[model samples]
Target: MAGRLRVVGVRVERVSGRVAVVVSLGYDGAVVTGRADRATGETQTIQVAAEAVLEAIRQVAPGQTRWGLEQVAIQPMLGGPAVVAHILLEAEGTSEHLIGSALGRSGPLEEAAAEAVLDAVERRLGWFTKN
Candidate 1:
């Protein structure tokens, strides 16, 4: 586990009291689910891809600069109108090295994982690009 906390992207849907639901979009197209305890500030996230790890990084980068890769696309749900919802996660008890260790291979895996998380975030958050 490294000193710096690792930032991962999780589709935070609902937060009631001390509990919240977070879903991680893996690079292999898998949904890793978890329960976050706000009171204790502990997140027991499921096993996700390197992309998810990158998403976490983007969430808490150094400055205004765009973290990870550009062009995050989040598609809306079909056949229904959904209200925009955002879940703010306080990153603690996790680091990049810790996440990287779980992600297996470094370099490309990290980049791809980041991209995947961003895509999920964009879709979940309804982020759109101006053409």
Candidate 2:
């Protein structure tokens, strides 16, 4: 079996009052990066990070499935906040589906954002073992 794709890093920054997130993933010896933008608001960093991770995954595995984010929730953690993301993924040809969720936390907002995305990607990839 092929090795799984895993999120390696995430970077979040504020630009013109908006949030910009970049997500990096590693599979085998290849590295891929995905970017996303979001307006400043509650949990904006987390949202942008998640979107970037999803986008990167799509780029790496275009035929996997179409994904829709269902929910994102944040709770207090020891360092800062813990983000929980729920996503719905639908198969391309059939009606097969899967729900994936992940958790991330960090003292820094940007790192936390990236960690959340990494967690989500790990969980989502578990549903599709082929890639």
Candidate 3:
């Protein structure tokens, strides 16, 4: 594990009533990409984005504690729509819940979703991404 990872890119696509999200995370010049897809729905975009972030983390840094996305949504806030993410952290006989949010800012909803998930774990990612 290294330090905290940052969202570098997010790509979202909708085709044939299916939604796909890819989240790219950067750490120490290494970029990892995670992907998720589900049938399109009201909140499926955020759901896939959140799941993709967790997938990317697992790809580069395995054998760590557990990280599970509980919920994700984009709702009106801060004068605009904001993506909110709720996550469950499980580690060594302990568990904690974390919440994070980021404004949509007229960007791709997936971008906000990625940032929201990262924000949720910002403070506690020292070990999770430590190099």
lDDT (CA) for every model shown?
0.31, 0.65, 0.84
- Winner by TM-score: 3
Estimate, for each residue in 53-102, the C-alpha lDDT of model 3 and write its tens digit. Answer: 98887776536578899999879986689999999988778999999999
Candidate 1 residue-wise lDDT at 31: 38
Tens digit per residue, CA lDDT, model 1, 1-131:
11223233444333443433343433223333333334324432221232244444444343332423222222233532212212232223321211111121332232333344443344322221111
Instruction: Order the numbered candidates by lDDT, best leading.
Output: 3, 2, 1
Clashing pairs in 2: none
How much is the lDDT of residue 1 in candidate 1?
13
**Stronger candidate by lDDT (2 vs 3):** 3
lDDT of 2 by residue, 1-131 (tens): 16666667777778787888888978888888988887787456667777787787777554757766655667676655666666667775654333333434435554554455556556556556555
Off by over 4 Å in 1: 1-16, 28-78, 85-131
Superposing every Cα of model 1 onto the true structure, what RMSD results? 14.8
Rank by TM-score (best first): 3, 2, 1
Worst 10 residues of 3 by lDDT: 122-131
Q: Alpha carbon lDDT of residue 106, candidate 2?
A: 32
Give me the candidate number with maximum lDDT.
3
Error of 2 at 66 (Å): 0.1
